[model samples]
Target: MPPTATPESSFSETAVFGDPVAQQLLPLTNGRFAIQTVHGFAIYDEADLMTVAQSIPVEPPGWPNSTLSASAEHLVWRDKNGRLFVQRLADEATLDEAILLEVPGNPNGWDHPSFHLSPQGNFGWLFDGEAYSDEPPVVTLYRLQDGAELVQFRGGLPQFTSDEAFFVRDTAEGLLIYDTTRLTEPLYTVPRDEEISIWDIDLTADWLQITKYLRAEKRPFVELRDVATGELLHTHVMADDETRVTPSPDGQSLAVTFKQDDGADSPTVVAAGVRLYTVSGELRHEFLAPQISPVPIPSACAGVWTSRRSDPVYSLVSVDFAPDGRSLNVTYNDYVATPVTHLYATDSGEKLAEFTGHESLFVANGRSFISLSTDGLVQQWDTATPDATPQTIARYGTPITDLALSNNGELAALVNETGAELRRTADGELIQQYAGATAVTFDPDDQTIVLGFVDGRIQWRSLADDSLLSEMSDYAAPIRRLAYWPNQPEPTVLALAENDCRVTRWQLATGRQLEPLHTILTFDEYGDVIQMSIDDFTLSPTGNLLAGRSWFMYGFGVWDLSNDSNILTELEDQPLGVRDLAFSADGRLLATGEAWPLGGWVGPERGGLRLWQIDEDNVSLRWSTELDQFVGAVAFSNNSSLLAVGYSSGDVTLVNTHLEQFVGRLETVSGVTGLAFAADGRLLAATTRDGLTHIWQTGSP
Candidate 1:
């Protein structure tokens, strides 16, 4: 059965970025820029030189941009999971995300594609740069000139050649060229008898170049097709056993290299030749291999890693004539760790100092170009001046996964591999930083912050003064959570292990362990008194009851927090699938959810919720409702009137506890990981594993 459709939420919306790190930056009109993070996008005005102001959050978290817009009033980006999204600049009020496409589970076929935004930003070219080995390649051509989609299709990226007449697509049928003016119909189609595999495809200003190996003929071939009509202009084939073909940037010359089998049974290049051709396939000039000193990675520019020496580690391979055909460039084609491109004089064999990167180069001009390195550093190179040293625009900050500029371009926010930071953009100076933090909790006064690191390091800091107060580092295990206590005189921290049942208390200012108590007393399958996992647990707002899931026992338990660390009651039924549970604000009603049962007679018929009425000695079940999918999250309203449940299938059901019936449903593509009710019972929020938080208002009308 199909899931229920979620209606439009009527509650007002405001996005929250919890220590978000910016990954990409795109400059827009009037000194405003879009700072993109793995979670969301923030538009900031750079009116002030030092202070960032009026920063507004737009789009949902987890909507990352593969490509960004500059002049057009829209944002174009693809999420890390290969979901495409486009949003108009004007409509910033609602959840109006236009989902462009979805890449399947295995996105190997849809990798490394470039987002081609038109000069005016009205149109966008959606594509995969390389062809897939299994399925037919597809692309979408979107015309968003008027902020509405004009035309889009499943094909290859649009071809905007100098002739501006045709674009090509590799459909299941075959390679077909279509008229740019009329996008729906193909003007010419390349005939094919059987299935064919293309190695590399290049569309230049005046021609279409396709490189493929024909198994029937036992040879590799490069075919040049005419742009006006998809007719084969020329076919270059290898006569020897092993050969490599490289087309020039202008699509005029084809460099052919013949290889011989060395003693190791590997192909060794012994002969090479460059064959020049005209637009009509006429042979222009042929140049053979010449002896010369090869260019290397400049001594001034150091490689990113230890393997990146001052000199070239590998030979200058894969030769291709430059656009002007005056010199030749030897570079690596595949995406390698340490990538470098060298320029050599093809005729004189003189070494040149120019070495570009593996991917696209940011060419400022014909002689000068800029490129973003594989290590996320910006590099500038000048081809005209051979002796000029390389200039690094932004020095790389290692261990930081992402970085972006603040609203006013005065500061930069970075998501560190371990934590997060705010740095000065001008000099790369560290301003404020956190160390190895996995989770953070603030005190009620908002003056103290307790941080839990993955390495089991717990520390306290003053949020008002940005000073470290105390820290502890001898937990023997990583800390999973840190909670701040408000009713204490000195700051107190409650830390829980990632998988254990003990909650350790520590003095925030002294860094001293106050006490260690086990929430659940249990023995393993061997009946030993050991640290059994409290698979799932939650405390009531009034601290009256502490409920937990007993994985090995195949049931859940309730602890009397007011008395001692003892299980006041236990319910033996369905095992805890996700350890999902919640209690009402008054502590009188408890809502517990169970996951799918393991290898047993039970199934999802038992995967549902059970309402419990808490008493002094024991708890009694009120009612239980079976759910469709395994439970992932559960929550209750502050007033104890409504119960919200989330499933592994991303389905959320709102139930009226008074009426014992489900009233509404919320559906999400990404499964829910967390759920909560606002303090005043005004907002209901749910968070996904992909970092998306959905919050809406719910109250009695």
Candidate 2:
């Protein structure tokens, strides 16, 4: 039997009290930009960063260049399927009728196709080609008013002049100039040596600036040529260390980045600084990279910059001029450290602003900016208010593997690539960080935490001073989950090893392992007996009952932990498999949630939420309900009055556990990863796949 798809729910929405992720930011006009998220993209005015001029509920292409292209009056973008769209930014009456055109090649291909809008917003161009291919790239020019193709040809790189009257293509033979009115042939060509590689080209009203590197001399130089006559105006040879050169929008000045060795034993060559130069080769200013420690040094040596034996060095990533060309943006990073972006005054050589932890920066204007971090967080900054917080326009959060909440609900623990982080639940402020931790859980008293590492080591640490209370290493695989045993006489915890697929109980005070519980078994395809492991488990509040789902068989079983006896094992009706389980506060009700199997393995049942009554010696299903998406997490209120089921569809459905009635639904922008109810049952915290955490106020729901 095939799985039945559930219909969407129509319940009154519950407001999210706390949301921690912001939309991503992309530069557009001089003082405007776009904010994108999983939902859609919205254009914002930078004056106050609040006015939304236009918004479209369409997902942008995966490639950054194809995401959005804006001119003074219009916006252009391509969808994943190579469909190009043009929208007017100002006129509300023309907003509904956006011009659309189907581009020829695969925009989502490995070649990374890009779209560019003309300065006047009257023309658009699309470039498509493979990076390593010998064939020339395909270029198509389109008239934006009606989505009409103006011309199509094979070109190297296209540069449009400011007036939009002419464009130039840098080809293997030379630079070919094309007139907007006459599309038949090039007006003239500026010949160049075959051995010289053109790094970048910028076209101005009267000058064509080309940055080229000579293969024989191992050097780079800039050439200024007359745009109309194809005659060389000036040739400026740069220093050998100067690797990259970028011309300002007006083509009057240039920004150059260089690298040098720092006299180390191994000859550590790093990007030393940036230099501002006139078109005629006169150096205007030089700004050097700051020498600083990547991490915090001792307090005693805080102000003493020379105390550290070795300072961090950075390699240049990119350099760009502001839209107005009065300032420059330089980005660099030590491969192993956080990247930094610095804005400097082009004329004075004075550092205007410095932003750390960003891989790239875009200047909308002299006062407005957008930055992208390595981890996918996009921020917008206003230079006028340097002391104020930057706006979080977008975030691509690191995936959270596991999550745990403190008993008092005041703190939340999460595990990711950087180990465990303790965050305050109220406002999501990071309180403490623990490195190399794989799993974490809080004690009943909420004063200490137990952490499991990848090396199978477990440690109990105090929350106040972060002192290690006890530790033990008894396993040989990564610790997957850590949970405290409820209603225990002494402090006890259960640690599950990922590869070992076995749970080990340990005494927190003595660092001793306790006796093993019941062994889980299943039958193979050939009907032979095989030992199985638990994928997920939950212990009842009284510590007398335990429920777990098998890793291989997809079945789940209930056992009496005190007597070490299996009470029941159910393998029916569960087509996919159980993902998570939770026991009610009174230990009388058990809830199980299921997730779809990996690798697109579909079954008759996509999985849902099931409520069961736990008797003295048996378990019986009280009620079950199917959801639109497979259940990802489940939690019961402290008073056992409500059950909150989080689904992969980013919807959380609350139900009256005793009445068996639907309550309300909460929504997020991504799939829910984990869910927990506060100790007082007044708040619910839900973690999502987007690395964001949302807190909802539970008001009688």
Give the candidate number with the greatest TM-score.
2
lDDT per residue, candidate 1, 193-296, as tens digits? Answer: 46346666666656888777787775667788877776788887655543566666566666654433343453443434444445345555554433332223
Write down the TM-score for model 2. Answer: 0.56
Worst 10 residues of 2 by lDDT: 1-10
Model 2, position 550, has a per-residue lDDT of 63
RMSD of each: 14.1, 12.3
In TM-score terms, candidate 1 sits at 0.44
Which whole-number lDDT from 0 to 100 does residue 458 have in model 2?
Answer: 97
